[model samples]
Target chain A: MTDIALRGVDGLKVDYLALVRRRRLYSALLLVLFVALIAGGFDLADSRNAGGFWSGLSQIFDFPVELVREAINKGAALPGNLWRYLPAMIETINIAAVSTLLGAVLAVFLSLLSTRGLARWPRLMPLFRRVMDTMRAIPEIVIALVLIFVLGGGPVPAMIAIAFHTAGALGKLFSEVNENADLKPIEGLSSVGASWFQRMWLGVLPQVMPNYLSYALLRFEINVRASAILGFVGAGGIGAELRVAISWGTGRYDAAAAIFLLLFLTIVAIDQLSSHVRNRLVGGH
Target chain B: MTTLDAGFDLAAAKRDAERRAFRKRMLTFGIPAAVLAYLVYVAIAFDIAGLAARARMDNARILLADMVSHKVHVTRDNRFDKTTVAIEGENKGTYADDQWPAWVVREGASTVVALEAGNVVRFDPDAVRFDIPDYGVLEIVQNRTGITMTMPAGATPEWINASSSRVTVTRPEGRLTVTKTRAEVFRYFGGWELFFFTLDSPFHGKDWAQLAALAVSGERVRAGESNLAAMASDVWNNAMWRHKDVAWAIFETVLMAFLGTMGAAILAVPLAFAAAKNFAPAFPVRFGMRRVFDFLRGVDGLIWTIILSRAFGPGPLTGSLAILFTDTGTFGKLFSEALENVDRKQIDGLRSTGANVVQRNRFGVIPQLAPVIVSQVLYYLESNMRSATVIGAIVGGGIGLLLTQAIQTQKDWEEVTYYIVLTLMMVSATDMLSGWLRSKLIGGR
Candidate 1:
């Protein structure tokens, strides 16, 4: 009886060791495969590239150095260049801000219409979800380019394009927040014979408002970057100005540097501001 | 005395409650009012009123129509007495002599174009005649000196614009333009023509049933390949559509996103440890590393793309490097934060097991960080796919370059539609893939 019990314990120990060994082998194999994939991809990209990776590595700093040198040489005009592009910078900011506002409004409706318990038309929930997915999938540049064709080059195209994307993105996040909301208030509101809009406004919004605002603030930061990039494609902003400056080549790189500085400062400022606000809103909760 | 004290306390509470309610009311109304005022200002600044004048409705109509339909141009060169029928007037889409569309018939010295709804345009040796259904026939003749138009009506309709050098009659069905050198008729038809097979391909006009039959049992169309292979090769190499190039571009875009994202995550993990306060060797290293992250992110992807493209010249590698540089900063920040939040008990438990620092980190810390790292990486992978498109545009590679080129041409709206559909599919596929990967790797969280 003693020998049998000792053998049973020994058998259990052996099985445990085997399991651990198998897990380690699998992990090691996965790591090797991942490394191989990365190396292969790097080689493929290097081959397909116009300039070889080794050659390009040495010249990577050439453009930046030239830009810095020109900016320093034209140091006196730097402030003036910044001032000249201030309005364009403002336009970019305004595009982001207005699009965020419009998108948030649209998102509120979309989220309400798409969320399970909150939806006014419950049967059409999937339809609304698919709409959001399609919108989210489309890159803003695609819409901005198309709208730029119809509407001509301006901030409006960028605004509408960014807003279209923002609505979809924020809608998904808003709906997720809505899913976690307390339903008792909603039930109570409905028991009181409140309208769909009233129940949502009075009950659900109060619960999800903090989360929605935080997400919107984050999206605003992203949208600012998007709007600037759209401007590079001729949606009209500091990006358009940057394109013009860069196209002038070496002599006008000072203006380009000034624009870059403005863009960098603006992005960092907004990033810091939004993160601070988001922390307050979410952390306070 | 007790009743009087209680009543005074109740009155004070009511006053405070009323103040709070008033503030809430102010907030509810004030925010919307501020937003409305700002929108009004934006409207003025962006020139919303001027947009109506600036917007080209004609262009919108053309884009919408061209996206769903194509036009075939029938040209009759007066000097050479030669007639050619081409889809979208492209050289690649020009029909062979005997394979012209049935609607266009060559009879002796004239070509008759039968358009929709009884709108017939005939290009004769001397004159171009357009017979409209409701409106009377319009004749345009180009002499040595100039072009002249005559309509069988009291006044020439606004659709007919006749100048000395050119006479153009535009209709819903078709358009006829008569010039000194050539007389052209554009007949609009639904669906993209020659999208699968160009005019030169033997499989150009085969229906689905015929194609399937050819694929299964029919003899080979070319000498060296089967009918199925021939058909696929023709479609893949179709010059008008460039399906092969498009596939390559999509692959390049995905490659950019993958390499950029994975490379950044790989580069960031070690840096994240250096940046993390609890794991850093010293305070200065952490501070310097954090500053490096900030600088990397602050430069932004746009700046990085411009700088890198100048170095790498315009390709997927440039796009990948740009994404790598920007995302490294983002991943570093996120990863370090995650590292700071790691449970101390796990590392302590590993230490108690007689593990060294490396072993402790490998066994204890990595497992704890795996889920967060995987989830963040997957999320960024999906987002980076979209970014890759934009970067590809800047660097002149991938589907983004194709899209921009199509749009820039200002005439290839159908191609634009194709690219847009492909791009949407590509991004959504990546989105779904990343979501699936995240769920699988992180145990459905």
Candidate 2:
């Protein structure tokens, strides 16, 4: 019996070592392959690019340096330029805000109608889900550009485009939250003769409201960035102003600098604020 | 006396519940009201009321029409009295002398277009004539001075507009225009013209069955090349659409996303370790790394694209670098949080086995964090595909450049629609791909 046990122990040790060696070999192979892929892809991209990577590497800082030097030279005019662009910046924020609100409202209805167990019309749930999928699939720029052609370029076009996308994204998230919500309150509300709207409003919404708010805040952060980008594409905001300033070239970079400063500061401020609020809402800390 | 106190307590509790219910009711109504008030302000600020006047419904009509239809222009240059037929009036789509569409034919010196519903238009040497199905004959005579038009007898239809310098006749079947310099007729077609193959290609008019047969046969459509190869090369190098360039552009877009996302993830892991409180053990180092990440993120992609494009001179490289710069910050922040949240017990267990710091992290921490890292990276891969498109536009690199150029041309609505559809498909594909990977790697929740 003792000899058999010793042999079994020795066999176990050998097997364990072999397993470790195999894992190491596999991981080493994966690492090598990954490195090779990165190198090869970089070469391909460099060859295809208008400028080679090595040649452009040193010049990467030249533009920023020039921008900084010009801004410093025109320091006295910076504040005035920033002030001048405040309205456009406001338009950017308003576009984000309006779209978020409109999208969240729409998502509330769509998510409720599409959530698996809680769907009002279970038979049509797949159709609503597909509708959201299609909406989400389309890039905001496509819709924005189309609307710009039809409605002409403005904040409204950007707002509508972003809202359309936001509805799809938030609807998916909101339904996820809804699926995890406790159904007991809903059932109790319904048994007491509450209508469908009342059951959802008084029961399911309260449970999911915090998470919904958290996701909405995050969406707001993303939408702010999106709105700015759409503006650059001619939706009308600081982006348009930045485009104009940049196109004016050498002497007008100070305006461009001011816009950049505004955009950076706004993004940072919103990021910090939303992260704080989200932590409080979701983490309960 | 005790019972009375109990009753009083119950009453107080009841009053408290009523107050709480009242607050909830107010909140339910108050939030949406505030939202409504804000929207009203936005409507005023955005000038929604004036949008109607600013909108170009005519542009919409043209865009919708162009998306699904093509027009064949049968143009007669009166200066030289030379006639040509082209699709969409593009020189690339011009038909050869003998390759004109079956609906158009030349009889003697006149070119006759058989428009839909028996409407016929003839472009003759000194005159243009249109016979509408219901309306009487409309004729125009062009001289060196100007155009002379004789409208159909009786009241002229609203669709037909005539002047001394120009005359245009419009019907559901086709359109006719007469000017001193030229006379043209446009016949509408239901589908995209020359989408798969241009008129110049020998394979242009072949049906699918014929193409399939030719593809397998030993015959060579062009000398020194197989029929299949020649057909493919023709489509790829198509002058009208530039399919080869478009395919390259899409490839560039994907390359940008892949390189940027993977590069960011790689660079982020070490920086994340430096930022994580449990790993760095130095306040200043952690704080500095965190701030660096914040700075990278705060400088949005648009600004980065501009700065990078100026340095790199407009290409996929600039777009890729822009994404890399922005995503490094996001990934760093997320990775550090995941590191901080790692199960300390696992590290302790590894330590009991005499594992070093590196091994402890490798076996203990990473095993716990791998799921998160993989899922987050894949999610970004999908979203970065989208960002790459927008970045591509700003940097003048990929399909976004093609799309923007098409839209800017204002007359390439068909091309714009094509790009939009392709972009949608690409994004949806990435979304599905990432979701599949996430489910496979992390186990679906």
Candidate 3:
């Protein structure tokens, strides 16, 4: 308003944002720098290890496409070992799905213990809240590692671990959603001697169902990706296979790369699906 | 009709009462039962109290115990990383070479020994005494699971301070005696936990390490070995290990999450402005970024890592970039939500004077959001410390690469513990620094 150089149009003022004007220049520089850095790293690694860098990089690109393809054609009748691989991939996704489901169930109970809405037992609520905080503080992988011994190295342990962590995460989110809910219905129901559970089921769930789904789906997507790697500890998945390929003698990396593509595409598909569903649910409101 | 309606009403009332009672009991009993279950798990883990309270350093007891059990082996381990195997059968078609660390003698020369420490040995002078001071306790177990010794039953084991300077035992037992060297071997290898071959070595001048370096030198060591010294070396050289190819991937991971999240933050501002009631109050922008976060953070980091690794291939760049996109979506949600929560009075005052939307934001929004943005950024940085960890593991990023390596090789656990500790320190430090920055930005108010 103080500067004449700045003009107003249609009750709106236009201002130049610095980052936008430099987008082209910034992107160009970023690309150049990224490539240079990567090249330099490979060069240095190659120099130091004689053939380690080439062997490693080759594993990323060369082996699987050649050896696995030949192996399948010559004797196995399977291309890229899909027959051996697909089940593990499905199991990985299942680990994420079941974990999310279990977490949702746990979160429902945890929400009741939280202070986001009801002021029931404020003292106990804080203590319980702190407990949730502590649970969240522990990393998911750590949870998985510990549970692995009891559950054995497979999807079950990973599911339990993911569930425990997601409960902490979803429980916190649920409490917040509850606190922001339209409190009128809840209070009215309570005034009429509706029990806490009944009030929650009727007043709270209706408002927060969308939220719960959004979180559960999100957690499921993550589990699908995580299961790929969780298998290195004998958990069994794409990641476990990837690790096995890396550990194999000579060069067998292309197989890992090929499978990684499938895993990535699956994630993209899941991402699109979740986005579509979330848009429909929240937008209709 | 009146009678039927009355009966229906009575039934409904009765059902409602039963439900209420069930719920009340659930809260009273169910919650406590769950707590009981959690406590049992905690007790088993030896980490029961650390759940609610901060962890205290209590390695003094562990360190003391280690010194006694470790005595000579710990000293030899200070130099190099290698593993040792003992061979007892010489004439059984097994190659008897000095280069091979094995024992071969007449059958009469072999002697029995006590498994537990500080037990009295009732030795017959007639028995052969073999000397083997280099083997560990587990190796001793490997050697002797079941044997019928003609010697008399040994006395009970006595309790004592680990240092043995203050020996304390209630009842002493007889010791099965082996030769001096054999006794030395058993003494060297015992007193540890599961997974003895993890790469979590602590280079505190141990004896076994020196011997390993001498035996396995130069090129032979890096051939993907599975032995004790390798495990010890992994722990001892962890800091140096950070320099290997894995380190670059880790840096890439951090850069990717931070930069990508920053990108989301940038986009979030305009959308957040549009969605806010004090500003655009429009349906499209405010809600878009708000949902972006739920979409981004909802999916797991592992998902992004796998996806990006596929799209880009396995490297720090893929992992990092995946983290970037995922984190941005999350940061956008948190940022936009924070924007929505901003005090409306500032915008209202500017608007009343006919100030334009752009001007209002500059003067009103940026300053208020600065603290929130910084705080949120710091929180993401801390949160991503863990995310970075998961990303690393997915492919070959950061310390996670080391973890995968250790597992595959069946390396010593001492090194594995070291890398894990290093990771914990890194995260803790980041968390602390973020907290400090947050307080400073908020002016400690």
Against the native complex, each candidate's DockQ, computed on alpha carbons, is 0.80, 0.72, 0.08
Over B85-135, each residue of candidate 2 has an lDDT whose tens digit, in order, gives 999889989998897889889999999989988999988775788887767
lDDT (Cα atoms) of all candidates against the true structure: 0.91, 0.88, 0.54
Which scores better on lDDT, 1 or 2?
1
Ranking by lDDT: 1, 2, 3
Ranking by DockQ: 1, 2, 3
Cα error, residue B237 of model 1, in Å, equals 1.1
| Residues A1-285, model 3: lDDT tens digits | 536335545223333444555786887898788667545643442343223433444454344355446454544433445556776666667666666777878877777678556645666888767666655555566556544433445556676777787787778777877777888888999999998888888877878888777777766766676565566555656667756655547534455544554565577688779878877876677
Order of candidate numbers by TM-score, starting with the best: 1, 2, 3
What is the C-alpha lDDT profile of model 3 across B199-223, one tens digit per residue?
A: 2233223466664764466444445
> How many pairs collide in each candidate, listed in order?
0, 0, 60
Interface RMSD of each: 0.8, 1.1, 9.2
lDDT per residue, candidate 1, B92-186, as tens digits?
99988898879999888888999999989988877888888877888888898988788896876787788899988888988888888889988
Clash pairs of candidate 1? none
Instruction: For candidate 1, give the lDDT of residue B169.
Output: 83
TM-score of chain A of 1: 0.94
Q: Which of the numbered candidates is closest to the native, going by highest DockQ?
A: 1
Error of 3 at A249 (Å): 4.6
Residue B171's C-alpha lDDT in candidate 1?
86
Q: After superposition, how far is residue A168 of candidate 2 from its true place, in Å?
A: 1.0
